[model samples]
Target: DLKMLYSAYAMEVLSDGHLNDDKLAALNQLRNIFGLAKYEAEAIITDVKARVFQTY
Candidate 1:
């Protein structure tokens, strides 16, 4: 459930299909709020980025 929450926030952050520094900072802030470790967040972020950037 927590991962889902993070994923959702990540989705919004990457909505434009880009992960700029500001977005990264915002995601990092949210990551801290969710109490997820860097490694965990990295994994989820990676997956979300891939999905968000995926081309049909």
Candidate 2:
């Protein structure tokens, strides 16, 4: 459930097709809040980036 929430939030943040440092930092904070490991957070960000790229 928390992962889902984090994913959704990540998608929202990435909707603009950009992941600037500020946004990355914000996502990191979210990742920490969700108790996700660093690798897990990277995986989630990578997945979201792939999905976004597919649409572009």
Number of the top candidate by TM-score? 2
What residue runs in model 2 are displaced by over 4 Å at the alpha carbon?
none
Q: What is the TM-score of each candidate against the true structure?
A: 0.87, 0.92
- TM-score quality measure for candidate 2: 0.92
lDDT of 1 by residue, 1-56 (tens): 89899999898788788778999999899889889999999999999888887842
Measured with C-alpha atoms, the lDDT of residue 3 in candidate 2 is 79
- Each candidate: RMSD: 1.3, 0.7
- Compute the lDDT for candidate 2: 0.89
